[model samples]
Each structure stands twice: as structure tokens, then as C-alpha cells.
Target chain A: MKVPALVVQNLTKTYDNGFQALKGISLSVEQGDFFALLGPNGAGKSTTLGILSGLVQKTSGSAEVMGADVNADAFNARRYLGVVPQEFNFNQFEKVIDIVITQAGYFGMTQAEAAPRAEELLRALDLWEKRDQQSRLLSGGMKRRLMIARALIHGPKVLILDEPTAGVDIELRRSMWAFMKDLNAAGTTIILTTHYLEEAEQLCRNVAIINHGEIVQNTSVRGLLSQLNTETFILDLNESLDAAPLLNGYAVRLAGLDALEVDVTKGQSINDVFTQLTASNVQVRSMRTKSNRLEELFVSLVRGSAK
Target chain B: MSPARIQWVAFSTIVTKEIRRFMRIWQQTLLPPAITMTLYFVIFGQLIGSRIGEMDGVGYMAFIVPGLIMMSVITNAYANVSSSFFSNKFQRSVEEMMVAPIRPITILAGFVAGGVARGVGVGIIVTLLSLYFTHLQIHSLLVVITVILLSAILFSLGGFINAVYATKFDDISIIPTFVITPLTYLGGVFYSIGLLPEFWQAVSRFNPILYMVNTFRYGILGISDVNVWFSLGMLVFFIVLLGAFSLWLLRQGKGLRH
Candidate 1:
């Protein structure tokens, strides 16, 4: 049988202060899959990443990368995994090129062998121009890109990004998304944890939502989105309406003088709402979802798990 | 590459990076010790030595040179590792080493090697500075090399341990100020321990720095208050004990891991 990219079996972590961070969380990611592990803050997402990367020890159970146990075969396991932590952990005084090249050295590559790869990654990430500059001198977005370059220097089979674009601007965030999509397409398995639900919806093929140290939901993105019984969209009308619009078999309410909120159930065609709106003499200007679909699902799942 | 070769590459990489870190800030790492040692020679060797005359049948200036060299080696070695490792901890850059596939021993050795390099580097600079103050002589080349290298190893390990337990910037400074400075001064870097009364002389034996100084003095002046063999044994013993303790701490994930 082919080995999974990452596997966790009954993993648990309890801190020294008697607080349990993880409680027997199990997960698996197939090779070359784009996976998302979503959780609210203090929901064990970072702790799970910490355990898998050998930064934090597990109190019980096990985790493996490419079938190599993290505890018993850490060297081999780590050889297959790369982690971009939530915080910037490289030396601020070191040059960008040095940081990426040094990381490759830690993986046992000579400077001669690491230089070309470091250069290529830097160029790919648009950081080659800033290669000679100290890391602290780079902009926030550039620093984030430098971290990605450093993590990818060893060319690991599995990459875990813990909020890789946490504080980035929209343009930079989109560019990072495109880069990550290309990376995933090239057969590198990616597991990301992000607060931005839109990123998870757009990028991840499968996802696991963790709440209070447990896996609350694990399913393909399509399956999870399919579970949504209804979706709400807001429509801006060209003409102001004094009263709420009444549409047969659809719940519609006037949100503002010129806006309407409509709830469309699963299996109900959105075309029905347009037909009803046209018949009611409402001319729509623009339309948008009230909230991201995955975000709604995430909030509901976390609330259910909390209870 | 083979696994052994890979381990060597990682080890060398750490050492090289560490060396570069210090060299990049030469004013902080290399220059201060040279300036400090030169002041010591002027105050203690030139200004006072002429008044005190010869010590143990040698010129007073010549007598104190080895101890001063050893003193430089000891302090710089300890300071280099302590400050470097503690800064790595504070900045969280040590996470790079923690997550690597390198063995624990290799990590420990890398930091220790960096400390040794700085220690020995400063020692060489101090030795060259002492030359203008006095005519230096080595009683035994073997002892001179052994004592200098062993002292560097011993204190580098000492510095590594200090960094392990340190949680704050002030914590790293406390041991060097309260502990290392006093021990080094009382270690007989200037005068012979025999000048003290029998009771004080006995107390001096327990100070590890005394053995290091006296043995290094023996290497230079052919005179020592303590047995040379016994001093060598103590140096080796401390190196082993401290090295083993350091390796254990790394494996336990003491300061670097969680």
C-alpha cells in the first residue's frame, strides 16, 4: 500500500500546567493533496503542528510523516516534512540568502549544493532582489516569502504552513495563493491552518476542523459545503422598495431601502429568485454572499463541538 | 552522501555559521577582550610589576602572562556561548536547529566549537598584546597546547549550561558577574596561592579555576602551586562531566525545545 503523506493516530498533548492541548486527534492526508486543518484560536491547531514537527512532545499516541514515526524515527520523519511556523524564527541580522541556504545546510546539504536551490527558490518567491539585505530590513510580505523559501529549501515531500499569510495585504495574499497552488500541483503535499475561511474554500481539497482539541469534522470540501442546507445572498436593487418583497417558496426580506436578503435552500435554483424579483418589478444591480460558505459551516461546527 | 558525511556537513555548517556570526561583529566579540587584556597588562604588569619585582624567581610581568591568557580564554569562551545561545533562545532562532535532522550531540558540539573558536581566538590576540609588556617563554609546548585547548573546551561547556537555564537577559549576566568574575580573580591569576596562609590555601584548591590557572602557569613558568598531573585530570574530568550534562540537556529538550 502507498504511504500517506501524513498520519496521526490518537495523538494527545497535555501541558505542564495541567491544561490539555490535544485529546487524541487523528488525521491523514494523501500524497499531493491540498489539505486544510481549520480551528479557532486555542483550538490545538498550533499544538498539533508543533507535535508533528517535533517542537512539542506528544503525551500519548503517535504521528508519522511518510510512514516514519515522529518520535521513534524523527530524523527520517523530519527529512520528509517542512514547517512554516506562525512566527518568524530566523535570525533578523542574517541576510535573506544566508537564511535559506543555512536551512538547507541543516538538512545536510553542502553550501555548493544548497546555493543553486536557494537561489531558485528566492527567484521564484520574488525575493532574489532582497537576497543581500538583512531579514529585518525586508518588508512584512517579503519576510513571509523569505520564510517560505527557507522552508522549501530542502524540498520536503510534505509542507505545513501555520497561517503563512496571516498579516499580508490582499494582493500579496493572492500571489502567495497562486504560488502555493503551483507548488501543490507539482506534487508537494500541503497542509495549511488559516483563519481566512475563503482561502480554505478556494484552495483545500479536503479539510479537518478542530475544536477544543478534537477533530470535529473531517471531510472533502465539496462534501462539507454540500452539507449546508441553505445559503444567504444580498442583492442591491436599482429601485428603492418601501415594503419587503414576497416571493413564493423563498424567504426574502428587505435589508435596506434598495437591498434585499434572500435565502436559497440547497437544490433550489438561484434562477427562481431572479424570476421572482423580475416579476416583482425589482431590478438587481449587484449580488454577494452574506458570508463565506465555509465560514458559516466552521462556526456552526465549532459551536456544536463546544457544546 | 552517506549518513556520516551528512552529519559532518550539518555539524560543519553550524560551526561555520557560528564563526561567521562572531566575525561579523568583531568589535563586540574579538576587540573587547584584546582591549581588556591590554589594560590588565598596563595596570598589573607594567605599573605594579616593577614595584613588586620578580615572582617565583621570574619577572612579575612574565609570571602573570599565562594566567592572563588563560583568563581571557576562559571568560571569552563562556561569554560567547552563553550570549549566543541565550540570544538564539530569545529570538526563537534556535528552532531552526531544533527541527533539523541533526543529532543532539552535533548541535551541542557545534555551539561548543563556536565558543572554543572565539575563546582561542581572543586568547591569541591577548597573547600577542602581552608580548610588548614582557618576554614570553613556554616551559613545555605540550602543556601549553593541552592546557589552553582543554580550558577552552571546559568553559565552553560551562557557558552552554548557563545558556540552557537562562530565561532572561539578566539571567545570563548574573552568573558571569556574581560567579565567574569572582572565581577567576580568586583563581590565582596574578599571585601564587602559596602566598596565602594554610587555611586560605586549602580553600583555593576547591576553586576549579585555580587548577586551570596554576596548570597554565606551569606550562609557561615551569612553576605551579598544584600538581600538574592532578590539574590535567581535573580539566579532563570537568570536560567530560559538563559535556555529558550538556548532551543530556539537549536530549531532554530543556531550553531549546518547548
Candidate 2:
């Protein structure tokens, strides 16, 4: 019942070249929730993030961060939010610690406070050892981590990340995820956009998918996965089939040598397919799920909306 | 820290970063200009002046000193900010400040102040070098200081505008080469405007740099070529105009906006 940390109402944006980036997008994020925004390239995710952070002007619509109108009171609104841009954009000549501390200063923090906070955030992100190093000297992943630490320095209530681990390695990505989850558990509302579906599957309790500048889906993770009525399972048959075998009551196709691909829809049972195959004197080998209902649901929704 | 204090800290931090970038590569950013200015004094005052003799009741060397100093101030101030800002754009690092909570006006002031600092620094260096060739007679210390400071601020603002609109390295060089260089030369940096034909003298009144160099000359020599009040009035007007334009560009997110 507490007020959501962010409430975006019909947020729209159009560039001068007549490209519509956001088409009346509306959504809300509950306080302290870890929300994931999933989208393909050029799907308005960055534009939405820009509008929320007050960097990009909206053609129409309104957004409120912690009840502060982003358009009307940008400074107050921005004060409550922190943004980690996808691009590596800090001044290369600046040291890592300076980058983090300067971000704190923008919100009016003194050196006494910002220094310790910067150190803490940098150390927490495993950047303490690189504090004195110029940002230009840091590796790509290190620079990206520095940006994350910079965003957190002001102790903003809401944190927005745009493709935080786009090109990062798996190990670093997981560590970053763990750190973000910890922040969210500590009560910072985290909003992130990513192309990594499994990351959303594991870390986010709620997910929003945007396509062609419009919100296609906004719901709890479980709720969205539940929308799928069909799932695909791959069965490694004991023997290879020369042709597509008949498996009644379910769609079945040859996956590969010694494998059968089976798809089960709503109101149909895998037992029916198994019973028919057994009756036909077919021997069963090993079996495994090829695609989860959740993945199927997401793919169908995004791809369907694309068309 | 309180909010007001945080904003000031952010402002100073950006300015410091800008200063560091230019200083770190002093050879590339600072050295070339000093060398170029030194050559100008040598060739123009020594070589050319020997043939033209004295003008404006002062030695050929002294008559061109103020013009040369103003020339260095204008070019350095304009170059410092324009190149610095353009480099940020090329490297796409200006986004660091863009995403932060700092006000647009503070960002404008920070870069402009950085540009002014470098401009004044280079101006003084060039002036000290000038002392080797001629004595710098101070007609009005206050006027001399005021003219240098204002000119620095004005050109720095112009540089910021250049950086904002420049999309490439060529974009940065185009204005300095075609616009700024020609204006400084045509502004009477070497010879007095009285030598020009009447038609050309009438056309000279329109050049802004002429007003600037002439104003600096008036300060150093206590002599007037054009109305001193008109020059001072134009400098103030440009400051306001440039300030407002730079702020507007900042708010609009010019090249740094993204």
C-alpha cells in the first residue's frame, strides 16, 4: 500500500527526425522492488531511462520519482534517483575515486561525506585497489563497475541501470547481480533494462517488456510465466527414426539422431503422448525440457508484438 | 553535505578535471601556442617592423604588443574550451556530468571558468615573453586587467558554443581556422587601421575583435583609436548574450546533452 517509488504515466518522446522513441508508455514500480525492463535494441528502453533521469526531454506525459514530478521539479526528482548509463562516459583523465566523489558532489555532498561514501562504494564494487588509477587506465569492466559505484554515492532511493552487463563476462555479471540484489534487499528500488532474459528470470520479481516504444507486458514474474499454456520437452529416443513418428494428442518432431521433440499444449497431458508411444512399442530413452513455459511465453509475446 | 554545498563541490570537481586534462598534455595543448605567438612577435615586430618603422607614437614593437597579447588571450581562451569540450564529445565522456544532478548553469560556469583560467594563464606567459622584446607601459592597470579578463570570458563562451555544435574534429578546426584566425588578423593585430583605405576603415568598424584589440590598446597606451565607451559597451553586451546562449545550449543538451 506504500506509494510506489516511481510512477510513469503515458510517457512519450519523439526526436526531431520524426522517430518516436516512447509511445505513451505507463508503468509503476513498488518501493524496494527489483524490477527488470526487457527489450531489444532501439526499443525505447534507453529513451525511457533518459526521460526518467531528466536527461532527455519528453514530448508529452509525466513521470514522478518518489512523488517528485520529473519534468516540473527535475532537481528534486533527480536527487531521489541514481542512474548508471550503459556507455563508459567518465572523464578518462579523472581518477576512479574522483569520478565517484564528483557524482556525489552534484547532489550537494561535501568532501567529508562524499569521500567515505565513494571509498565505500568503490571498495564494495571491488574498485578500491584502483582508486588512484586514472579512469582511462581501468579495463572496460572496471570502468563499468566504477560507474555503478558513482551512481550509488548519493544514496538515492531509486537506482536505474541501462544494460549494466551488456558485454561483461559471466563471472563479473553474476557478481554485479549479487551486489545489486543486496542493494535492493537493503530497500533501494532497482530498475534495470537488459537483454539477458535468464538474468531477469533469476533476479527480478517483476518484469516489463517494451517493444516499438510501447509497453507490451507489465506484471509479476510468476504471473507472466503463468500466461503460457504450452511447454516443449525434448526426449532422447533409444533409437533413431527414419521418419516423423506419430505421437497422438501432442505435437512431436525429430530433434536429432535418437531424439524426439514434443510440445504439450493446454488441456493435453504428456501421459497421453507417453501412453501412445508405449502402445506403439516405441522405447523411451532420456528426456529433458527444451523450453520452459516462461521462456515460451516471453518469446511469443515479444516476437508476436514485433510482427 | 547539504544540497548547496554538494552542487558547489560538483562544480569545482568538473573544473578541476578540465584543468587536469589540458595540463597533463601541456606539450600538445600549451606549448604549441606559446611557440606560435613567439614567432609572431619575432617575425611581425622584428622583421616587418624594421621596414614599417614606428606607428601610433610608439615603437613598432610596443605598438603591436597589446594586439598580440589580446590575440593570444582570445585564441587560447577559445581553443581551451572548444577543444576540451569537443574532446569530451569525441570521447563521449561528457555524459558523466550530464547524468549527474548538477544544474545546467553550473556546468556552463565550470567549463567557462576552466577556459578562462587557461586563457589567462597562456596570456600571462605570452606577456612575459613579450617583455624580452619591449617594455610594457601600463597606462591603466585596472583597464588592462579588466580587458584581459573580459576578453577571456567572452572567447571562452564562444569556444563552448563551438564545442556544442561540433560533431567532429574537423568541425572543431573549421571555425578556428576560417573564422577566428582571420578575425584576429583583420582586427589590426599588427598594423594600425589608419593605414587602410577609407572604404576598408569603414568596414573595419564592424569587426568585434577590432573593438577588443583596440580596447586593450587604449588600456595599455592611454590612447584611443575608437570610442572607448563603445568597446566597453560591446564587451558587456557580448558577455550577456554569450552567457544566455551558452546556458540555453546547456539546457537544450547541445552536443553534451546526450
Give the candidate number with the greatest lDDT.
1
Winning model by DockQ: 1
Give the lDDT of residue A250 in candidate 2. 73
Tens digits of lDDT, candidate 2, A195-305 = 788788888999899999999999999888778787888888878887667876778888887888888887888888888988877788887889555567777888999
True contacts kept of 2: 0.63
> What is the DockQ of the complex in model 1?
0.78
Pick out the ten consecutive residues of candidate 1 chain A with the lowest summed lDDT: A243-252
TM-score of 2: 0.90
In order of appearance, the predictions have TM-scores of: 0.99, 0.90
The sequence of per-residue lDDT tens digits that candidate 1 reaches over residues B125-225 is 99999998888888898998899889999888999999999999888888889998999899998998878999999999999999988888898889998
- lDDT at residue A252 of model 1 (Cα atoms): 88
lDDT of 2 at A137: 93
